[model samples]
Target: MNRDNEKRVTPNLDENELMNLMVDGIRKDGFKNPIETTPAEQPENKKPVIREQNRTERISPTEYEEIFFKEVKSTARHGKSAYIDPVHHKKLTRIVQVIGDDNITIYAYLYNLLEHHFREFEELIKEIYEEKHKPLF
Candidate 1:
């Protein structure tokens, strides 16, 4: 390995912009790791915090009309099956068909529904789970 000829390239970006870029990259790529910042390092503007909030919470969709009718692509990941009432299943399928796009999958809509439910009841679910479960230690 030659030690002398390597040229280090550093991007001429503001520290705040660099951090924002990293955060955006992580979000776009669906990386789960949290980016931690001390109070002093935190940006003066609250825009980043608002941007990082859950999409459903930030949008605060008032009705199914806002959330369910949007066009979305199918997820690449495999999903586990949970049986529901046949009526419910048929209703979901009908909703997708009504969208007039055969390419959309029922699972995406179902996933969005579950996401909304979980976000709405997140605190209660956490509290109940903590109360019910005892540590094995």
Candidate 2:
């Protein structure tokens, strides 16, 4: 058979075509390809099925308590948290700028200011307190 009349086939063929050649005992330049059983011939794999996440999962009571009360604890000891007007907030920020300490925080400046005006600040905070917590005499 003339090479020109015969159709050309490359060594790198598709997986199915290669399998078919192996079954047919065809080799390319003495390089034999291994025969792989068809996927249908193998048993179906029992893959672990994954379910969608429970979007409406409820938080546990302990988890809720931890998150809700974590920050609301004694502000006097931990530090007071106030939602002041933006203008006052900016003024407080300016005080830290004037102090010229790069490491100083707004809390330190605010605490220092409160300590300076303890009489006034004490009265203001006391007025908002639910009940006058008196120490046992």
Provide the overall lDDT of each model, using Cα atoms, as 2-decimal numbers: 0.67, 0.56
Assess the local accuracy of residue 5 in candidate 1 as a C-alpha lDDT between 0 and 100.
40
User: In candidate 2, which residue ranges exceed 4 Å CA deviation?
Assistant: 1-77, 119-137
Best-performing candidate as measured by lDDT: 1
lDDT of 1 by residue, 3-60 (tens): 5446656657577656766756645444444587787887787334433346555564
For candidate 2, which ten residues in a row score worst on lDDT?
A: 65-74
Question: What TM-scores do the predictions have?
Answer: 0.45, 0.29
Residues 42-81 of candidate 2: C-alpha lDDT, one tens digit per residue: 5568333355366336667565333322322223558656
Kindly report which residue stretches of model 1 are placed more than 4 angstroms away from their true locations once superposed.
Answer: 1-63, 70-77, 99-103
TM-score of 1: 0.45
